[model samples]
Target chain A: MFNLFLKTMYDKRIFIIAWSIGLAFFAYLMLLFFPAFKDSGLDQLLATLPPELKALKGMIGDISALSTPSGYLAGQFFDIRMPMFISVFSVILAVGLSVKDEEEGYIRTLLALPLSRIKLLFGKLIAIVVICVATTIATVSGLYLGALSVNVNLDWTVVSNLSLVMLLLSICMTTLVYCIGLSTGKRGITMGLGILVGAGSFLLTTFAKSVDWLQPYEKVSLFHYFPAVDIVKNGISIWDVVVLVGITILSILLTIILFRRRDVR
Target chain B: MTIQPVLEVDAVTKYYGSFLAIQDIHFMISKGEVVGLVGLNGAGKTTIINLIMGFLRTSAGKIRLFGEPVLPENAHKMHPKVGFATGDMSLFTNLTGRQYFAFLKRAYKLKDDKKLGELCKQFNPDMDKKIKTLSRGNKQKIALISAFMSGPELVILDEPSSGLDPFMQQKFLELINHEGAKGTTIFMSSHYLKEVADVCSRVLFIRDGKLVKDVSRAELESSHGKAVHITTSRAIRPPAQSSLLGHQKTANGYEMSFIFKDSPIKLQQWLCSISYMLDFTIEDHDLESAFSDLYSKDKSEAKNV
Candidate 1:
């Protein structure tokens, strides 16, 4: 299982490293030259937004802390950097685990090896976890380095706790993708469903916030489970962490059940 | 003839939803024997391979290797001891042949790199290049090298000769024969009857997903891996003719066809001494021709039924 996990990481080693460095370098440059933009893309975007659009992104205008450099990194890291970077990360992990193998016909090859379907699923699961964990660490590390450069009184505890939160969220989201992959099995359909489920879940949560009746739908939104804003403003949300971690376990159970029953070919 | 089978597929059936992919196939492959599973396209050669590898579900039958039941979980345990290569199983494109072999080594837990190279070179593959960069035949050789690299006890190959050139096809045969010499059982499928005839000790013809022919070496040799058909241009007219009708003299005489048993030497000499230019064409028996004879009746009968 570890061997398969290492190989999968090797497949995306160039991407994880390259993407991490690229995001870090770009974030560092912003801290050095364009501090205002670096610190306030998400905050400024939120402030200028109409009520409906703000609800769509699950945002409320609260940016007094954006004046501080370290506080600014937290906002941009979660909203701007993570949305695009995490989407790309999930895409690569899903493709690596399911789509690429299905395309190459190596799924059948691996199946022919002395590994059970569950074992195979576990291997991909391990790889996906590593990718998600690495990505979250990279984002936190980038902003931490930027904070050091700017010489702000950085909140190490806040950073570490929030980083763990995002890592759990990433895991939950990616495991959801794995379950989708298992059910669909085909590359295009699995990926299309994964993105739709991830982004669509976010969209649903945003919409739920706009309505009083749809408030229950907010609980189902993966975004609803992790409170990035709460983390920056008032420390970690214990309920949010529980909900996110619960979703991760549920998604993994789903992966195991569906993958075990599905036709491998 | 007296030895036990290394692989046994007994009453094995596979269905994809409602469609029966393969039905109750019963066959046993002895050690060191190269068996050719001959079939046309969509004849379920690949399905049988999947069943044997436990990549598929058995509808009503059982696949046993070394006298143990083959289930999904157990398949992997059996797979390490069996090497399989097919046209569909692509080697990693970005990885070189050596790298892919190394992965297989790690996967199968092979320790000796020297033996891996020897197994690869035995199949005439260049290990330094990536698989995508290799030619079609060389890619196949690489696949074969990986499958055989573990020195598995049994090998299952599907349509190995399709992409290979004539020279490479010969090399493929030599490679299979070499593997067989080492007591590895070979279950391979090919369209080329001559190729199967060269090395296969037994020829199994699959028609409409059923094992129609469990032909022995003697039967294949006698039939030349085909059903010999003799067609004559002229008809065989009997000495005593019916006098009930006065018939007009047709330009051509009567003709007859028979299964030609012997070589053309006997038939050709017999034709040359005749006064008339009677045609005595000998048609070679092949999997295609034999299969046509075997199942061509299904079309008309199915319509009536």
Candidate 2:
């Protein structure tokens, strides 16, 4: 099991490095623009904006709060850019863990090894968790360093809480994609469904803020549990953590059962 | 003393969503036996291999390896004692042959690389190059090396020689023979009947998801009988005393051909009775023709039904 885990991680070393640098750089770059927003009368500009632009505010959460560092970071980076980037990255990595191998006929070689299906899947799941945690750390480190360079007095505990929730969100999305990939064993189908779920969750959660009818279904979306702005202001919610963790554990269990029974292509 | 069979598949049947891939298939391979499974395309050859390896579950019945039931949960436990290879199997193309073997070594947890070193020497694949960079035959060599390097007691191969050239195929056959001589139980499926005939002690014939024939190598050779072709000056009725199969006439009824199953002396006596006979030739039947006969017979039988 350890060997399989190490091999899986080694195989994705390049991907890990690229995503870490890319996310960290993006986070740092986004923070560098925070100084400009801090002094600019953006709050007044936002208040005078057309009423129709309220939907954009709904998506970004509390546009008037953009004068503060946490609000600016959440609105510009965490709420949209970071989640979307991490979602895409997680889906790709999750699919490669199983469905891509099955599609390319390499799963047979892996299955022929002296490792049980449960161990094999758990090994891959561990690799995904480690990668997600590493990338989350990189993003937080970038934000921390960027905050220091710009002389912003950011609260470390709030940032850590937000990063933790973000990591959980990434894990939840990745495990869901991994489950779908193992169930279908087709790259295209798995990828299409993964994107649908990720994008749909974001859209549902975003629109639920303003649409009265969608408000009731907001909790159904995985993104609703992320609550980047809320986490930045109020710290992590235990219920949100429990929901994401529950989904991840359920997804892993479902993957193991399906993978053990399905025929290898 | 009683010897246990290395592999036993009892009444195994598999279906893919109401489409029966294989049905009621049963066979056992004892130790030191080199068995060949011969079938045409989509004849459930790979399906059986998958079942035996526990890659696919049996819809009904059971398969046993080394006396324990074969299931996905326990398949890995037996993998250390089994070596498997197939032509269509894809390798991690990103890794060089050396790297791939190193990974396998870690997976299998073998104490040393002595067996792997020997197999590399024998197959002589380009170990330094990436698998994707190698030719089809070279990749096949890597697969073969992977299978045998573990020194498994039971080696299961599916179209194991599909990508090799003639010389390389001969080398593979020699390797199979060498392993068979060393008490390795080998079950291989192939479209190449001559290769099967050369190394296998027993042959299993499958057609349309059914095992049509199972015979020993000597039985297959003798039961195929002699193929005779004759051209005579005058047309004559084939003798009833000679048990001929697939008798056919051509060349304006002057040429006749068929498989003769009777004694050669009896055939000679019958041939001597044909006064107008001009020429005749008799040759031992080959495995290819025998395979054709089995499948053709199945087709005719299906048509009758």
Candidate 3:
């Protein structure tokens, strides 16, 4: 069983390395420009702008805090851009494990071995989760190194905790796509649903901020659970953690059920 | 006392959303038997192989591997004892051929690379080359080497010789014969009748998802009597009332053939009664022509019905 997981990781080593470096570069750039934004008084100018414009730009909360290292990184990078990047990577990796192999005809070879379907499915799922965590670590490491170079004082413990939350959020998104891929075994359906959910949730979460009526429906979106500005300011929420972890577990169970019941071809 | 069959497929039927791919399929393979599943394209040969491998679910009836009902849950138990390869064998494009086999070696948990090395020596595949860069025939060679390297008890191959050159095809046949001699039960499907005729102890002819004929080695080789080509003093046609499978005009006189449901001596004696017959030559019917005749006869009979 571990052999399959190890093979998958090895097969996707290049992808993991590529995505990790790309996200890390993005994180480094976000931290590198922190002082320039604060020193140039753009933070003050942005603070004067209306909330609607900030939300439109995916700032999602107060812009005055853009001068602060944690606020700028979390609000601009983690809250919107980082999560989007990680979620998309996780979904693609997850689908590649579950459905892409089927399309490419590797699943038949795997199934011909003396291993149960549940074991194979679980093995691939575990590999996807490991990849998501590894990418999160990359993002956190880049941010930490970039912050150190800029002489910014950041609470390392808090940064680790935030990274954990990000990892869970990635897990939730990945498993959601995993379930769809396992149930349908069609690359088009899996990719279509993945993009729809990822993009739609971001849109709904942004819209719910100004419109009070959409607030209730925001809970349906995974993005609503991880409010980057709120997380950076007040620390992690027990409810959000529970929701992310719960949804991941639920999605995994649903995936296993569908995979065991559906036909291999 | 009788030994249990290695495989037993009973009245199995399959449907792909109202499209019947196979229906009422039944067969059994005893231990060490070399059986061939013969059919044209779309004849459900692959479907039956998929069903036995537990890739597809049967719509009705039961399949047994070692006398136990074959469900997906229990199918894996037979995997270690069975080796399978299909003509539609696709490989991981990113990995070199060596890496893919190394992965399978781990997946199947073979003791070491002993068998793998031996197979590589036989097939002569460029193990270092990426599969995407290899030709289709080379890919098939890799698949074949993988299937046979493990020395499985039951080897199932679909179109095993497809894309192989004549030399490798002969080598493949020899490999199957060696495996059968070692007491392995082999079930293979192929459209190439001569290939199957060379080694199979029995052949099952499937057409349009039905088992149209079941022929044993004896029946295949000699049941159809010899074809008699006669040369008369003059160009003479066969008597109109003669009983024979088929007759046609040749340059000399006339030639005819029939299934000698009786002895060859009786057939020869009957043919000798032709008054104009001067010289004649008799040859056993070849499987290719025999199968062709069977198919055409079935078509004409269906037309009458």
User: Scored by CA lDDT, what does every candidate get?
Assistant: 0.69, 0.84, 0.79
For candidate 3, the chain B TM-score comes to 0.83
TM-score of model 3 vs. true structure: 0.89
Query: Model 1, range A126-215, lDDT digits (tens) per residue?
Result: 888877777666666676677678665667787777678778877877776766776567778777876876676656654566676888
CAPRI tier of model 2 = medium
- Per residue, candidate 3 scores C-alpha lDDT tens digits across A46-103 of 6677866655544344455777777777777777776677567867787888788888
Rank by lDDT, highest first: 2, 3, 1
Scanning candidate 3 chain A in windows of ten residues, the lowest lDDT window is A54-63
Q: DockQ (Cα-based) per candidate?
A: 0.48, 0.78, 0.58
Superior by lDDT: candidate 1 or candidate 2: 2
Candidate 2 per-residue C-alpha lDDT over B136-244 given as tens digits, one digit per residue, 9 for 90 to 100: 9999999998889889999999999999998889899999999999999999999888889899999998889998888898876665567777888777766653334
**Candidate closest to the true structure, highest DockQ:** 2
- Which tens-of-lDDT digit does each residue in B51-162 have in candidate 3? 8988777899899988878766567788888888877786777779899888778778888888889788888988999989998888888988878777788889999899
Q: Which 10-residue window of candidate 1 chain B scores lowest in summed lDDT?
A: B238-247
Question: lDDT: which is higher, 1 or 3?
Answer: 3
Reference-based TM-score of each model: 0.84, 0.92, 0.89
Q: After superposition, how far is residue A237 of candidate 1 from its true place, in Å?
A: 3.5
Ranking by DockQ: 2, 3, 1
